[model samples]
Target chain A: MKQKIIIAFSVVLLLFAIFLIARDLFHSSHSMTDASCCGDDFTSAKQVDSTLIGYKRIRIIETGLKNLTGIAVNEKGDIFACGNMQVSIFDAAGTKTKTFNVDSVPGCIALSGNDLYLGSGSHVIHYDTIGRKLAVWKPYNNEGYIASLAVNGKYIYAADALNKRVLKYSPDGLLLQDIGKKDSITGAPGFVLPSLYFDIAFGSFNDLWVANTGRLQIENYTSNGHFQSSWGSSSFDNSGFGGCCNPAHFAILPDGGFVTYEKGIDKIKVFDPTGQFLSIVAAAGSFKGNSDFQLGNNHLVKDIAIGINGSIYVLDAYNQINVFRKKNL
Target chain B: MRSKTQIYILVLIISLLTLNLPAIQRFPRPEFEGKYQIPATQVTNIQPAILQYLDIAVLIACMSLISWFIVKRRWRKGVFWMSLFSLLYFGFYRKGCICPVGSLQNVTMALFNHAYKIPLTAVAFFTIPLGFTLFFGRTFCAGVCPLGAIQDFFAIRPVSLKPWIRYLLGLIPIVYLGLALLYAATGTDFIVCRYDPFVEIFRHNGSYFMFFIGGALLLTGIFIARPYCRFLCPYGVLLNLVSRFSKNHVSIAPGACISCKLCENACPYDAIDKPTGLSVKNDNRELIKKLIIYCLVTPLLVIICGWTISKYSGEFAQVNFKVRLANELMTIERKGEPVTPATEITTFRSSGKPVENLYREAASIVDRFYAGSWIMGGFIGLILGITLARLTIYKYRKEYLVNKGNCLSCARCLEYCPVK
Candidate 1:
């Protein structure tokens, strides 16, 4: 009888072992079969409160570019979509204005008055509105990858994701200063870019705002490169930034409002001057798909360009610029 | 054995599993001011290379000591204590990595993949145990192997399984070995390491699925004794073959058997071969007929198994990450659904690699799997055929003896001999 009980218990344990193995195999196989869809985490995070979304996608301008790396809008509302060894311009009404070819694929683009500054590879190239190459400046840093460019009257700030520094260059492309470095005197906590997602933009006060993405904070620096203050938080809530590196790309509004686009969870949000969470311009589901940043096809929203009309032009991974406008507008 | 000590050990192990402290950060730490830089996350560096070599050295030393205890000293108590030391040192201290069991996959990968440079430590770990088993029988399993030692410690009331059940269940290791080799050779995965029942217990962390499986196997080990070594270990299959031709194997008696039945119930692993009296006369005509029939049937079984497994090679190829991704992409296209932009899909797009190139690469891997599955299936079929054929012939013995292929050389039967 004792042996019988032992045998019965052993049989039960054996069945349990078989069940465990079978369950594991089933889960793995199920995951493989379900690989065609987004993961549960992604799905759960994708569904945001629709009422919180303050903006709507107004238009999708298909630039016909094979790969859209960066987009910039000028004061005159002429949109420049640069990628695939060419820069295509679209008017404020989403009409194709002009297109020009470059020697190499433009890493990023910024418009200074009528002249366009293209960050191609590690160097900056000056171009006129009609696509004439004006001057090619020396490479700011040969090893640097210019992921973003923000230009002002006196200087051009190139966000170098490789060196994890913002290179401030003169109008003629002379190296001026390296901003966002850790400094005891200036109280600058150096930029911690986990991936190639450092972005820089000029705020309403002309103060430089840099996305310290790894820290999930937006830092403010003086135009001359003095550290001022920073804001933002790390959270899965639509009001906060999350993931490895977020606020992947951001553009400053005329009223000093911040338009921030995050990768991984792929949500675009807006914040006031004091870094208060205002509203979500686009949720994760608003884009083509949820993009978890990786080396090769990283940028979900490659570049966020704000139009003069407060329209947010998002250069999505699908090589199209999605224009989002406030629902009140 | 003190029940209190056993309970304490069990509690300690459970605490290690339950205390899932945010020990290892999966993401990079936020950089703060001052000299606080987040350390670089190392992908696969569990231990340093020097320590890896030390693990090999320790393994050899332990196996040598256990081999001496089993073969020369013939001391069961010494073997038991040494095995406990191995369980603590190799199992818990080293976290059961660089084990000979998992090293077989490294050797297989190195053989099949030209780019894979088999680490010197892996080569040593794989060969040293086989070399020891060749000379001194399965003394490695007797105490040096932490997987076996852990199970051995739990085997207090091991009941003898029927011969037919043992023979039927024994085929699992062969099938597992074949599948492990196939997966490794194809560079799909290291399944032997992935499904190692005791490695998680040794690490005190890992997939909960594996932890539960390990717990279930341990519970069953109370009655069955070394269930994994006998029926599931891919590495044990190799040791069993090598130990069969061992020069110095374990002895049931110090000298000749006194015909006493004391040693009959001694082996918990049921490796003892009882004497077959002369009353069972050998029938040569019947044996020859069965042998001829088995010879004819074995090759047919191999072909059938090879063809059947080859037919399902596509399903098996899904285990490969690349093949699975390609299949997913194709499925999305076929279903007319928007690509969900998974990490793999996004990375593939950003690579600027053409979709055709990915599909072509995945197809090539599937072709390799097709060839590997045939061989894997034929290997399993051949083992099954041999196991079935082995039942037809029996060697007549006048005295009780140890089955060298089956015995773990644990030295338990040595104490049962009154002649000692």
Candidate 2:
């Protein structure tokens, strides 16, 4: 009798197990067939041609380097691109010149004369133009993520995205001051860096231009880190920056205009010095399926560098450098 | 034995019929113009931390009850009820997160990565079970572990496997433990949690392939008897080692055995050891020579195993997503093809991370795997040598005894013992 009861109990348990297995198999097969039905929907939703008027693609230079992070153009038109663990320098004619390895993955680069500064991890490494290591700067706080770099004649500024502040260092690699603190008295609203896209550039008048990404605006500060003025608006249209954080990266054009790259919509636009909306340089259609701008966080091709002759160099997410010139030029 | 065989056949027929019912039933179909949609408002309210504390308390209570039922009352029914409660609370209600089995990886990751903060509950889940097993001989496995509970319920009409086959198959859990620890320590992957078979059933959503695997395991458990616990559970390997040194363990008989041999075949797990007579008639000198030879060859076995596994370090490193992505990018670059970046590549490029740096980091991880795999292989070889040596040595016993390492403290043998 006990053995019979055990048999009945085992049969019930076995039946339940089999039921769950069959149901799961049915659901999986149904989902697999359903997924195929939506295959056409995926291809048909390709981004349309939304190219901003005025700029023309002059040349597309294949850098051959994957995961390019930062790009900077010097006065000599020498382009330096920072990627994974090494930085590659190219001449104006798009010829590779020098390549040297850094200790850590280089994040951003800034070149002043023959001195090149590369943000590798927490430290800003200074190297000579010929790829010789010159000086290693002091580690920014242990937790800081140095995402962008900008340099002038006297000081080098590192946009520490993780700390949400900018560390200003003297030419000799001495810590000078921390900027962009949330101080109501100084009226510094602070830099809002939700992700690691904080970028900085030195303007024509030596003003520090910082991409306050989270607020969807660019703020200018004096050489000594005083809050100056800011301009930008959040909009999904072509007139303003949009998405979770607009203008993920920016560079100062020679004419004091701003070349800004918005991540989610993957558009590169030009703004006047007063932050007035200018013409579009590159549109979302140009990037096509290359950008990842889903939801709030956009991780697309970043960093814009303006060449000496006014040619705009944009690094796509895959590290391919796209050079855009004025249409009539 | 005749009735047991008859019951097994009867149960098998019923189960097969139950499985065939879906194919036999034909219902009138209802047509729809478009896909059927069920509007599900998924309001995911994060459960409070205090509730997690309550779960810890319940786990403690279950373990205590299981220990009492096994050691004092010698009641298998009590253990089964406690196991059912564990399956409901930990498996169904808690969705099997923070389980001691998965907590092994968290504890391992915390030991290696300083930045990783193991939650207090995870530490509690990990240590408490091992602590209980040290004194009570796997009361946690007998009742409190949801993974074990779910499997134990399906284990009926289990046939005893050959001793040699059991010994060989038993080596798998050690290998699994080695691989899990290697992956966790090197920050490669949490293979245990990622490949947890039954977690999908508990959570009600997972990979389709994993669901099939889970169902297949439960089906196998019907005849194999706790297949996951005996062969695949890395934490069970730890418990097996800890239970060996346990001060108290479940005994087959409540008092005297009387050498009746009735309870000899009672344990489906083959944990009951038949009594060996007072003396052995084997040649002692030959046995001593074989033991010495085995001891000398053990290190050589370790070296060969370590070297062989280390050769496949590159393949093992593929378990890491970064290493795999870096390898893919490198392969594309080498092929001189136009790169179409995937989502991971796009994310990597947008983060301004360096490709050379990624490659270098991946190479370093591959090196770590080379060393880790060597350690894993050597550890397995050592375990094999020790198991072999123990099996060779014979021990004298007055009566039948429960194998401390294999007995789950379910107390099934207790009912068959006439003295009890």
Candidate 3:
């Protein structure tokens, strides 16, 4: 029995090795398919085009946002983004919105109707869509290092990047069983080190889509957290997330297109719903930041929202939110 | 009839790739070259650091192959030449650049973020060792790497880890994968560069504690097995991965074992994963399951917790807040805001040309691309871990190796059979 098992094991290993080499050799066979569309700076061009949304391009608003990490959209279409010790909100027309003061670093955000959920050092605080504080949802081991957050129906999901799992909770702050990454059926890397989840929104089918900060990839999971599809990685070119770990966050447009915010290179890129990278709404060169600060910390750009008629709102880290009116859409 | 011809063809291919190295060297791949202005592509990276590794890697490949062909039948002698060559190159000629293991950075750079990466010539250097592993087994470990050469010099008495402990330690490639990505993600110095013990050996010092640990291991390598070859060297792991799947394999002689197990007993790395007298599936299943479980739990948690932590609560951040203040302090040197440190470096690099004024017009570019980064780490680790573990778990049956399909018909192992 041992002998047979040994041989079988070797066979399995051999087969696996063959699969890897074959895949590797064939990688360039696709050979940068559709390079034509992305070349000549198609993505960079889209970031500033008026049709996609105004936030697609990097714009200077009210400056002096230090470590701004999270952004959200309310029912009234007002824009709010989180920074160190403060949250900045803006109206729909590129006007100066209100800025809220807070004590901790706000890393993630979620908006439900008039209620906004923000993550701050192991505590989840509730606010009226108008930015008024309501209730607090604190986890058992909440150590303030929350990386990303999402709200689906009544359930809220928060990734404890350092702890390597996502905590599920009810709106009233009740603890639910954890969907630990280890429990995931697909064999994937653990999220021991989590960064920003730029955007998290309910899909048409209610599944959750996540654009992870450090991985430069977006992974989709069942509302219950079963792993499904994943795409994107660190890159400067249109096909990949630019930088060591980027495409930190993203927003899914009402039309199912995606606008991703990356750090290392500092740009926002757009993609068709099916994952075809389209264009860059904005590039980092237009923005001013620390020499070392590519696109990290509370550098939040999560405010991607479609208006009643489909205009897009982007909450730049600056005090004012930028609005884009799609000429065609 | 044409195995040698195929080998020559591979050499030719590698040579062509090598010839293209200077072009790649002169024009640093855009990924590694961060831009000076906004919309970065227009800027080019020009640095001597780029060419440092390429030159040595080519020389090592050239000389090592020549020496190996000369001493084709002498295992230890060939290893001596290869290792001596690595030591001279790394010690006297090269600094911290072209080691084949470091080329992992290039492959992984592309696999992960497709950012600043190693040139193709650098890739060929790694391929050369990998190719040698296929054609000759473990010579890469015997010498050829400066890391191995340094350790070989200090090898003394050794103690072996139990098979299980060795197996557990062998799983380190996974941790290496995680560390490489973590540092890369942070835009920190390459982890391999910062922490390599051998680089320190060549450079003459390292972190006191880590160096001592490496020194002790090096001392322990002589009596038992090639300790560094067994446990810590990432390059060793890389070569081993290629060795297992190598087209030409090490053909051990019949009765060479004598079942004496001296080589096994002397071996320290515990690279030998003996089949648990139990069924291979029964023994290895739990470990595989745990590996899977560990991988999935964290990302899901990151997803959920990242959301929870994002919910903002108070007014401290409203206007000149503490977090904002701290961020500003950290960013001051880099941003337009003048600071002490960044000013000094730029000032120094330019011989006191006001730092800010020089880069004032230039905008930092995005997309520090390293091609095939994630995949490179992921694949290499997976391949090495799986291959080495498999080699340990099952000793190839005598008949299986004797009748091996891809043997270069070189019966070289037969000539060196000390036991036979």
Question: What DockQ does each prediction reach against the true complex?
Answer: 0.17, 0.04, 0.01
In model 3, what is chain B's TM-score? 0.53
Ranked by lDDT from best down, the candidates are 1, 2, 3
What are the chain A TM-scores for all the models, listed individually?
Answer: 0.83, 0.81, 0.67
Interface RMSD of each: 9.1, 13.2, 20.4
Which residue pairs show backbone clashes in model 2? A69-B352, A83-B354, A84-B354, A84-B355, A85-B357, A301-A317
**How many pairs of residues in model 1 come into backbone collision?**
2
lDDT of 3 by residue, A62-121 (tens): 535655555666657666777667777766444556777766667677777767777776
lDDT of 3 by residue, B82-181 (tens): 5556666654346444666666665666555556665665677657666766665555555556665655544333344444545655555444544454
Off by over 4 Å in 3: A1-67, A94-100, A130-132, A183-199, A212-215, A233-236, A284-310, A317-320, B1-420
Top DockQ prediction, candidate number: 1
State how far residue B60 of model 2 sits from its true place (Å): 1.5
TM-score of chain B of 2: 0.88
TM of chain B, each: 0.91, 0.88, 0.53
DockQ of 3: 0.01
DockQ preference between candidates 1 and 3, better one: 1
